[model samples]
Target chain A: MKRVNILLGGPKSEYPDELSKSIKGIPGPWVGADRGSLYLLEQGIIPDIAIGDFDSINKKEQRLLKDNIADFKKFPPEKDDTDSELCLLAAREKYNAQEYYVYGATGGRIDHFLVNLFLPFDPRFLDFYDKLYYKSATNTIRFCKPGRYKIYHENGMKYIAFVNLGPVTHLNIYDAKYKLKDFNAGHPVSWASNEFLNETIDFGFESGIVAIIQSKD
Target chain B: MKRVNILLGGPKSEYPDELSKSIKGIPGPWVGADRGSLYLLEQGIIPDIAIGDFDSINKKEQRLLKDNIADFKKFPPEKDDTDSELCLLAAREKYNAQEYYVYGATGGRIDHFLVNLFLPFDPRFLDFYDKLYYKSATNTIRFCKPGRYKIYHENGMKYIAFVNLGPVTHLNIYDAKYKLKDFNAGHPVSWASNEFLNETIDFGFESGIVAIIQSKD
Candidate 1:
């Protein structure tokens, strides 16, 4: 399946090289959203398609991008959907595959990040949740709905957490240092830092979407 | 009525002078959570009591804090609520605060920050939501459930966005450059930037916990 790539622009002090490298192997087109496009271009990683209203960039960058990219859609500053979000919507309709990968939507404004996390919970995004992979410099978060997943982690990562994106019941974790069986992992109390014992772990659940966050400090 | 000052340390990068000057003038005792204690200490602003399990701090910093502070609670590293959340809970039960202002909760970890934004939405916190404020360097986000708020911006900050924390509804943003009588501020369309015709702008809503992000830049 052709994978779709999206890079979001937030207050990431770091350059976009590392995140771009993660998607280097993807077998599909890449797109940048608003500030994300600027960050990538400044780092010498120009995306194929750039979306969103250029409210965050100066006039110079806007003119330069208009000349460089294959396609650029500049929306009015005041419009529906966040810039990255607009890209995701268009990707679903355009891509030949079901899977999608999103980057740079992790940090910055609390509300911004929260909404990024909440993206998979939306019905439109949920339909493709099983196929989405979001990565940051130190972490990768995925949405697994009502199924088991075999996950591996890099050594020396600081933490890993799993939270019920919906009303989850019977969340079981095994082959990890911390194990839990038939327990609730919901809004208030999430399963955090259940590390891998054998360098690989398996998890299964009966219902609801679970967001797994594995991190390094 | 006695006011209570709670410092929320989720992961904010900077704290401006205005927030410090205002909190320092809170006219009540101070409560610190996790990284918030370090921030206040760096600023030479001391807290009367500190709470939270201290999961975010390094061992050395944690030791220095244990050596210095007297009225601090150390819970198990694994807990249900966030450090800021536990601190707020303790602050409410112990101080019976008439009002509260939280700092250092806006910047870090999108999940933690998002949860903190809706902190006031918690019924436990909501009992006193009108008395709470969350301030960052650039913006101030506060909660007023299912009602209207007349937000005034300073220094020509020039952005007013309303997020639909609840279901889709008609949100009216009046007396602004891009005035909308009844617009469906879609869930994905949370952040809106608009110029002000007048210094003060008005926003009215019907339901859900709403956050007004009045930002600059």
Candidate 2:
């Protein structure tokens, strides 16, 4: 299975250190968005493709990106989609990977974080919902459709949360530290700060999208 | 009109310094959630009521909270509502304030942040939608219903974003740096990082809740 990793320009503190340390171990190509390209280069990893408006970086950084990256796509700063969204679009058009791991998509400005969090809920990006996994230093977020899911614990991630992006119905969670049954939520709700019982958690929902977030302090 | 301020247990860096300086100026009582009570005391402001599970604090901190705060309501760590939610509930029950200013809510664990951001959308707390104001050091977030409204720019907040909490239709933005008209969003979309042209902005929507967030870098 093909896997693609896309990095966006979020706070450096939120970036997972393991991703930088094991860049060669991860499968598929690396796509960088805006300043993320500079970050990849700083880590001595050359991105396969660099895409963004290039507004955040200085002229020196821009020159570095242009000289180093073979495939670079720059758009006007005034655009419809965010730089992160544009990277995802470029990844879809170019790589079309089955699994898309997103880094530097969380933290910093609340507005930016909100956009990244809800990008999957947008109709334009709904197809990428199940495929996308948003990973940060402290959290791993993924979207799920209506179905039963058996989730295994990620190393060092102790807290599990199920957030309803929209109205959801008949949500049931079993074999977890906290269990909910036949819960019908009318609006967006974050059932946050839950924990895994042993190594796995079983959960299912009848309708609407649920964002499963596994996080650690 | 009665106004209340709620402080949650988020990162100290995210808290606005102005809030600490102007604690005397803000009207009504103060409510602190869990470690937030300690934060309030550290800021030299005594909360009128403190409500939470108190799991995040140590024995010394708990003793300090009990000694400093007069009205303290503690619950078991394993409870239905989060500490932040519990504080809001207590505020509603005790004060029934028209306006609620929430601090120490953003910039933390994604799950915890998500829960705080979506708390206004819950059915139980929907009544506080228009009244709740989430304020961090760099951002101010407010919720609005489907209506034509004029938004005045907050001091030092340069960027304004309209985030659709759910499905929204006929959304229009006027007199802003970036403009949108009659946009139909089927799901959550954060039209983020838009700038302000003047002192005020004109915006309207036909349906669904919209979160207007103003932030500065």
Candidate 3:
């Protein structure tokens, strides 16, 4: 299975220290969205594809990105999709990766965060909902369709949350500190701050998408 | 109309400079949740009530809260509801305010943020959905039920977003940079980064709740 990592234009402080190590260890293409290209360049890593409107970067940074990155796609500032969405679409179409790790998508404007978080709900990206994973300094978020799944606890992640992004039915959770069975929700709800009972936990839902977020305090 | 502001344990950096001014200008009572009680005290504003598990603050700070606040409600750390929820519940039952402004509830753990954002969906808080407002440094978020509403532009807010928290029908947007007419959404979707055409814009939905977010870049 192919894996690709895309970075957006969120605050630098939100990036985990392990991001650089992961970039070096993972053998996959790196796509930079808007100012994220400048961020990657600052880290001494040239992105495989730099895509965005380039509004956030200065002239010198844009020149640097153009000089170093071979594939740079620039769009107009006034566009329908956000820079992050455009970059994700480009990565999806070009790489067709089975898995996508998104960085720099959180800890910024609430609207931007919401747009990124609900991207999978859009018709253009709905099919790949399960493939997208959002990573920040303190959290890792994943979306799941209606199905049974086992989740392994991460080393430092103390809390796990199951949030229904829409209407959901018959949700079941097992082997967790707080267990739920045959739950139904009419709208978005976050059952947050749950802990794992063991190394792994099991959960399933009958319908709707569930966002499973693992985070530290 | 009575208005009460609730502050949560989110990071202090997310608080706007105008927070203190608003806290002073508004005459309504203030409620602090967990470490937020300490934050309120740091601002030299004595909260009317402090409610939480008191896990995030030191013993000294807890003592300060106990000493200063008239109503102090402490719960065990391992409780069903979060500190923010507990505080809101207490405020709702006691004050029965018509409007609520939430601060220090953004820019922290993603799970906590999600939990706070989706609080209106909880059955306990569902009746007062329209009464809640979340404020951060760069954003003001409000929820609305099925009704027509006129939104006047805030002085510094540059963009407006309409987000369907659930399945929405017959959503209409008028006098905005990007207008929508009778649009229906099957799931949660963020129509973000839209601008206003004039001093006020109009929007309405036939069904479901919509979150209108006004933000600055």
Candidate 4:
């Protein structure tokens, strides 16, 4: 299993301990982007691949990263993709990994956070979204294609929101809080925050993609 | 200038400061959406219209809002539009305000924030996108249609990213940190955080709707 880990510029310290406890069992070759590099360093971990223009980190920290990390790829100051995204592209090359777990990815500025969430929608990564998993302090989110998914729960999140990630034409929630039958949640009204009724429930959608956000508070 | 002020939830204490600052020297009716009502109260200011399901605010706060505000309209929990959206709809009917300024909208949940940024794509507000302006602490963003625009800057930000908010055929940047000549920044490699070079700059495109984010680190 070629496992790949990508960390974006987020409030990693706030989510570090939580993620460490949860992701300890998952194996991977970690990659860092911008501030995400500094975050991993603070935790005494070195990234295998570091990609960015090096704006977020100071010169001394950049030197430390250069000396410690195995490979560092620097793009010009101007680029089409976000630094975090560039890291993902590099990640694809290195990891034949079956699963992808992203950290330091949630919270901080809303714009950056949203970009990462919608990134999976990119045609390049859309095919692999089902294998992707992301964990913030109080939420664990992932996208599921047309299939039956078994969600394993940790105690942090109280509610589970089944956002159509994109608009699903006919979405049916077999087991969840606020069940819907053949639902078409259009553009404006995305299922904002819905609760999960039971501990472990079965959910399978027939046609479209669904983003599952298991959140607390 | 038919100025309209729409207050939505953000930081509680900063709400008043932002509200007072955003509404200063503006002549128009004010509108609040969902918890936006409570946000105005946090600053000791109330809007003319209270729209949407007051679910974000507690029962006590809702009661206080109803007692103090005369035009309070509540929707069912299950509705087609998000709360902030309903306020804009109501504002169109009641105020007929052409230019809308959304206050205290950034620095929140990523999902809510993204929806707000793309609010222009909503069929209800699609035609009026040019009249919209979104402000964050370090950035003032505007979504524009294709052609060209001249931006005036009092101070320079470290970064300014212009993304094809919707898919664009061809985009050309005359002067920028990474100036481009008739480049195709299609869907996947969407323009992300990029820096600025001078105090004043010009930009134009061949086609498509674009989001101009004049931002910083």
Task: Give candidate 4 regions above 4 Å deviation.
Answer: A12-29, A72-76, A79-81, A106-115, A121-129, A138-141, A144-191, A194-217, B11-29, B154-156, B179-189, B197-208
Best by TM-score: 3
Per lDDT, the best of the predicted structures is 3
List, residue by residue over B113-141, the lDDT tens digit for candidate 4: 55566676567876677777665555556
**Complex DockQ per candidate:** 0.18, 0.62, 0.72, 0.17
Worst 10-residue lDDT window, candidate 1 chain B: B184-193
lDDT per residue for candidate 1 within B1-217, as digits (tens), equals: 4777677764444464565565455466778887677766765667767777777789887776776667778888666577777877777787777777677765444345546654553567767666666766666666667777787776735566665553435678888777776665333235455567887888787755566766654
Query: Which CAPRI level is candidate 2?
Result: medium
Q: What tens digits encode model 4's per-residue C-alpha lDDT throughout A56-175?
A: 678898898888888988777657677767877778767756888888776544345556766765777765777777777666778787777766665766666666544455676667
TM-score of 1: 0.78
Task: Candidate 2: list runs displaced more than 4 Å.
Answer: A19-28, B19-28
- lDDT over C-alpha atoms for residue B135 of model 1: 64
Instruction: Quote the lDDT for B119 in model 3.
Output: 72
Each candidate: how many clashes?
2, 0, 0, 1
Q: Write the per-residue lDDT of candidate 3 for residues B1-217, one digit (tens) a residue.
A: 4999899888877887678555576567789999888877887789889999998778988888898999999999899898988988888998889999899888878888888877766778877878888888888898898989999898799999998878899999987999999998778888898999988999999998788999886
TM-scores for all candidates?
Answer: 0.78, 0.92, 0.95, 0.78
Off by over 4 Å in 1: A1-4, A14-17, A20-29, A97-99, A121-126, A146-156, A164-209, B1-3, B12-14, B17-28, B55-67, B118-123, B154-156, B166-207
Model 3 residue A15 CA deviation (Å) reads: 1.3
Q: Given candidate 3, what's the lDDT at residue A62?
A: 93
